[model samples]
Target chain A: MSADATQRAPQGRTLSAAPGSAGLARRAWPWLVAIVAALLLPWLFFDWSTHRHSGFALTMLSEIGLMAIFALSFNMQMGQAGLLSFGHAILFGLGGYCAAHTMNAVKAGAMWLPVELVPLVGGLGGLLFGVLFGYVATKQRATAFAMITMGLGELVAACALMFMGFFGGEGGISTDRVIGISLFGVSYSSSWQVYCLVVAWTAIAVLLMRLQTQTPLGRMANATRDNFERAQFVGYDPRMVRFCQFALSGFFAGIGGGLYAIVYEIVTFDTVAAAKSATALLAAYIGGAGGFFGPFLGTIVVVLLQSGVSLLSNAWLLYVGVLFIVMVMYAPGGLVGIIAQHAPIARAGRLRELIVPYVRILLPGAFSVFGFVLLVELASFTTIGAAQGKAFKIGPQAVDPATAFPWLLGAAALIGGGLWLRLEARGFRARWDALMADAKAKGVML
Target chain B: MEVFLVSLLNGLVYGMLLFMLASGLTLILSMMGVLNFAHASAYMLGAYFAFTISQYIGFWPALVLAPLLCGTIGAAIEMYGLRRVHRNGHIAELLFTFGLALIIEKVVQMTWGLIPVPYRIPAGLDFPLFTVYGTQFPAYRAFMLLISALMFGAIWLGLTRTRIGLVIQAALHHPEMVGALGHNVPRVFTTVFAAGTALAGLAGVIGGNYHVTEPAMAFTMGPIVFVVVVFGGLGSLTGCFIASLLMGLIQTFAVVLDYSVADLLKWFGFTVTSATPFHEVLTVPLPRIGALLPYVLLVLILVFRPRGLMGTRDT
Candidate 1:
């Protein structure tokens, strides 16, 4: 509890923050705002006439909550400890497996555990594996560390399929979530009840993670990341720092996995696959590894692109890959960095000045994106979509993939709009630089 | 004895193919200190390109042209993408390649759909080379081995006997000094990357038909190549070659020789049942765990010998 208070101290000490009572509210405001938003978000998607909620929206929100915790735990390694883990899903999948087994035990009347605390079981599972693997993986640093984790991940994923006893092989383990032993005697079965629990666990996990980041171990991890030799000189073992960070990150990841198992009621080898590990890396990196909230922000974008955009497009993976490449090349600091860049403009109260430039850029940007998507859809329709007997339709009309006209239009729009966006982008950069310089000169930004 | 000979021959062929990919990877790793994660993509692209090209000009032309095309693409990637990311750091460069891998897989899926393409052995090379315990070893396997052998000789000669190779060898260890000596190091980096990718492409051209040609081939091949690379120790081609062959033999023989830990224990007079602590592990046939051997080898090597069999530096 005291550790939590100490961590919250830094949250109230920013330059724009007020002192004393005002600072307390300022510190509390974002959490308050987030809590209210979390509560109100599902209502917006409610169908009043049906007297029911959008199951899809609720499920997606729950997914986002789980992935947010997972991705944030990943950030503790990638961003804080400077470890690029290619096999993080091992911890998560193990946690889910543990939780699923526990839930089954409870159902079979062999265990007396309440359903709400299953995530803790998952966390413990994750922590155990993290310790076991971290010892081997953290023996080396940088690229070697990455390779070891990759090897470990492959080993575990392969093991998951090979060993049917624990992992249940190809079929996977499933359990009934309604364990009938809730603290409040609530026999939780509905998606609403599960979603509420997800929200609460996400809050607790996020808070614990925030607190963990302020501890001496976290600081030492950072120190090692920046310069391990110097950290060694200062009497800290870089390897031990990395090991602890990896283990702790696993603990949090396991919590997320527990929630996943609870919500989905099953865990598969797919959970331990390289793709799942890549998800955490993608969410953390695309969100921004610099800030505490970056992974959460990234989780929303990634899950939206994954779960939401996937429903509409056959070429969603292509979009994700392209987005990742573009971000790595252009916005290495990620979406958080892009948003954070405007802090000076916001502080100077001149955010509106760039609105016109943004609008100007948006037009051609939309044009190019539309053109690209058209080409992608046309190609997709020619192949997989055609195989599935689906035609590419624009509103009431079906567009023939064999025709040259759509191709010509897509190519022309992509070329022309790309050139136009480039010109507009140049102008935007100039405007942004000028505004940023003015703000810096006026002492509105540092 | 006959089964062992056939497996050994098959393993040697497979190992040479792996070495072709690993050699290119080693070249780039030693030269630029950047692990090109998309090397497998290049291999996949080579197979696809060959499949498409063979439809137009026949297999012989495709065998020549596919690698060239792969080299050109590799050069372009190096010039436009990798050169820019080089300033950011090795991790960014690696991530950039990782992104390329994802994109290439999706593009291949989009272009060819998800099924395997018919990139088969040409009529000329489809004949059986010799009798191998009644299972005829196709002439295509021999051709793959021949090409890989030729590549090995050429690579060795180029590195040892040529002027550019010597410069590259120097740059492998001392890139800054090589640059200070007025060598255009970036051009050297580009050349090596192109050459390395071309080698992988060549391997793909031959190996694709020898195996299956599919969209997922890159991903399936990606990890094992990485295992070979790590097991060989980075920056050491010889280590890579030895490790590849060892992995090949291990994988090949693991399939043919099906025994379990339980069997081995039983041979030592220990009675075993499902009640054993690791019954799941012990009872499973070695063939069942064939997919896991290379990774297990890699992990054990990293834990026991980080430098691997014959590397100058630690992993």
Candidate 2:
């Protein structure tokens, strides 16, 4: 079945770069501006008028930055190499552990090292582990790779418990980030400081990863993802490409882990658990798997859901699950993909022409979303509410349990909105098909 | 010797229980080419459903009803959820199942709470069946063994003697040919998924009382079941059976044997003391090794033989 599926998929033919003169300066400006903006971000937070000028926001931002790097690293494997790993936390956690232990050793006067260099130790640690495991894992692709990674993850986690000197048994390791010498007399004591450091590293890593996508190695990895035999026939060793990608991914993941250690001031088994790995997978996929910044956008959205949504409902997991399912079924390319579908229309100066259809489709979509949220919130209020021994109260009155009005209304909205969406989708497709046919025929005349 | 015999018996019982679960899993994995991360979640639901139903009716009815309920649920999932996600690709299907497992875990917790419920062995099978070295083997264990053995026999008979079983066997080797022979492939997939989940549910019905019925039980058992499936080989039931028995014996004997590497070293005229650099590892007890053994076995299998023991193709 898989062999047939692979055969049916278009082989990795190079995509025609959108025909245009080289926009070297235009492409370079966004990254340059982003780097400068990242550098000034910490300082900007010091302004009193800014709402996010606080310790908590800075810490949250740091966490987001770190996780974004981790997600990008995961994208390298899943998006580029076509390996679906569920145990990426092995690399991330090992990186954190290595950094923490190194910090501890430095504190004990066993070694003298600056905190800036500590992340390198962590990166090297991840690199070593990845190479050792990736050697065996890279021999097999797809499901076998996933299985091997899972086994290695479990082994490492179990060993962490057995060996207290390394993993600290379960409590993990804690160390002060201020132990090592500060760069340029900047004391690395505050979350804001860590935020600046992480953003700087994240920007660099993203830049490096983007460049990698343009490299021969990256192209080979893409080919390998399409077909190992094809890659072999083309004289590129698929295993070597996979191994290199895996190790580089570990480097970035390790940096993310170091930031984790720096932010939380502690590292534990939870940091490297399979659940954490699953979260990375979720974020990368939710963002869109094809583009460079897909995981970055996904990270922001997921972290928001994790931080903000969890406060209102314990069923946040249910919502995320539903979102993932919807994405897989309807929007396999993710949020980026949904947006990308309209790109050509906008490029052809027909942007305004679709506004009516867009709003028409969006209204039903919004209604459906609202209805879905209502159901989730109501369910949460019932289950988690009932669990917490809280009653369903509205203002001064507790709602009667026997009434079916709320459920009926929600159901009506769901069914009605869903039907409206189907009707709108048909209209949208008809218009889109007409536009495409016009473009093709006109291009021939031109 | 008595302890050894008792542990061996216990291992055999555990192995049989695992066989009930792994056999179903191996079939579904091989035929459908999905790992079914939610298989253990389905097992968990079966136990909870049986517990709930037993309150309304009785244990006997629940033993029959819960599996039917689970089978229907499995068929619905395969038809609606899996088939939809199947279009995107295998990884997406896996992710969907993974999410489904997460949601099911949460659902079980929301419905049943976090505490382990009292799902006791039937009163008829509560007494001790045998005594060995002052250790009593409960009649419930014997009944479990009997049920599992009967299940194995029934499955074997069904596969060997039934037409559907013949189709399934042919599908294992020549899925395309089976389809060409007028078998509805999608219907077969749905049936296999339902049957596999039903088998898991059956195991849950019988084993829930023997183990604790809790929300966390699925997570605890899920990985071990995966280990069995992977270690056994992706496309082979006989390998699954042997792997299950091997794991069962390893886990059972690991708890039974009260020795460490230090003990072996002492027997070899090398007295290990606390001062040794490797004392932490050498002196660690055998029970701790139990948890690590499955992963060790997994790594070894993945590294040395990616295709597994009875696999026709690499998983």
Candidate 3:
């Protein structure tokens, strides 16, 4: 599946770029802008009125950066290598645990390591586990590989619980990051300081991963992913390519885990759990595994939903699951692929042609989403919320769920809005088809 | 002796429940090349549906109705959801099911509340069936064994005896050939998927009461079922049965074995002190490690014998 998507990747690039060095520069520009943006974001979001930092914002931003690295690392196996690892977070978690240990050692003055280089220690720890497990995991392909990774993940997670010295059992290992160690004589005491560290590591990790995609090893990994037989016939050991890629992916994931440990000052079994692995998969796939920055965007969007949406409702995971299913079913190339598909049309200045159609589709679409959310929330409120002594309140009105009025409204909105959305969607499809034909006639191709 | 007899019976019951779930998964994985990650979720739904139905109409009627309901839901999902995603590839199908599993868990929680429903065996069958070494064996367990045995017989007969079963068997081995032979392959796919889910639902009906019908039961059982299917290898029912029974026995026996690796090492005069390397790993009791056994075995099997015991296909 990924093989088919990667085959069309160059075509995606061709829509917006000229060949040669100009295209290279165009590609490189995003990385530079991303780095600059990462560096400037904390300052940009500074609170002037309080005369104090927005620690929450900084922490959230740091989480995004950390998740971005994790997702990107995951994509190395998933998109580029076509190895769907079900246990990618083991490396991340192991790295975090190792980093936590390092933090403790540094705090005890038993180690002279600087705090800035802690993530590298984590990366090395990840690489160690990655190589060890990758040797076994990379022996198989596809489903078997995925299963083996899951087994390994479970094994490590179980061990993490069993061995308390290194893993610290259920409560996990915690450490103080403000251990009087300085990188450039800066105490690194504040969340912003940690956020800066995360941003720097994220930038480095992203750049390294992007660079890896251009290397011979990366190209071979893609070739191996596409066809193991073909790769083998061409004198490349597909297993070796997979192993190296897996190890490297683990290394980067470990770095992300290190950042997580450093920021949180703790590492636990949750870090290496299958759920954590699922998070990486969701982020990478939702963002567009086919694109370099797709997971980056996915990380931001998912982290926002996780941190932002979860505060208001307990159905955040439900929403993410729904979004993922929708993406997989309808848009396998993900968010970036959807956007990239319109590049030629946008470049031809015919983008406005679909505005009416988009509005037509989106109006009922919004209604459907709202209806669905309302139904889910009401159901949740009736069952769980009521039991918890929380009333269902919307603005000034406290709606009693026992009444049939709200239920009717929810059902009608869902069924009615869904039907209307279907109708509008057909109209939008017709308009889109017409616009595509027009674009084709105007010498614009997608 | 009583402990051994009881553990054996319990193991058999649990193994059969696992087989009911794993058999469907094996068929889906081998025939469609799509691992239905939401298979356990289907089981969860069956339990929830049975719980609700039994509350209204009693257990006996629910036993017949809940699986049928699940079969219908499974058919709808296959027709609308899996069929749409099938064009994309197996990975998409897998992800779709994975997402479905998540949604189902959440939906189950929302609809049924967060707590486990008091879904219990019927009073008619709640009494002890027999006494073994002065220990009473529950009649519900005997019923579970009977139902599972009946299901096994039915599935075996249907697959080997019926016309549709022949078509399904043919489809499993040669899907493209079956398609070329003017068979409605999509219909067959849907039927197989529905049948698989129905079997899972049936397992849920029995297993839920045997264990507990809760929101978290799906997640807890999901991985174990996957391990069974993988350990048995893909596309082989006999292997699945063997793996399930072996896993069941291992888990049950592990729980009963109070000894640790330290005990074993003591026979060789090796004392496991606190300062000793891997002391926790060595001293941890067998029952404490029971949860990790299946995963460890799964890894070992995948690494060593990828085709699994009696499996014709490599997973």
TM-score of chain B of 3: 0.98
Q: What is the C-alpha lDDT of each candidate?
A: 0.88, 0.81, 0.88
Off by over 4 Å in 1: A1-25
Against the correct fold, how does model 3 do in TM-score?
0.95
User: Which run of 10 residues does model 1 chain B get worst, by summed lDDT?
Assistant: B306-315
> Which candidate leads the pack in TM-score?
1
TM-score of 1: 0.96
Residue A147 in model 3: shift from native, Å? 1.4
All candidates: CA RMSD in angstroms? 3.7, 5.5, 3.8
Consecutive 10-residue window with the lowest summed lDDT within model 2 chain A: A7-16
Instruction: Report the poorest 10 consecutive residues by lDDT, candidate 3 chain B.
Output: B306-315
Query: Where does model 2 exceed 4 Å of error?
Result: A1-24, A35-52, A385-412, A436-446
Better of 1 and 2 by TM-score: 1
Could you tell me which residue pairs clash in candidate 2? none
For model 1, residues A1-446, the per-residue Cα lDDT tens digits are 33334334444577556557877786778787887798689999999999998999989999999999999999999999999989999999999999999999999999899888999999999999999999988888777788788889999999999999999999999888998899877677888888888988999999889888889999999999999899999998888899999999999999999999999999999999999998888888788888889989988988998888777667777887787888788888888988989877766567889999999999998989888888888887787888887767866787888989888888888888999999999999999999888777756573
A51 Cα displacement, candidate 2 (Å): 9.8
Docking class of predicted structure 1: medium
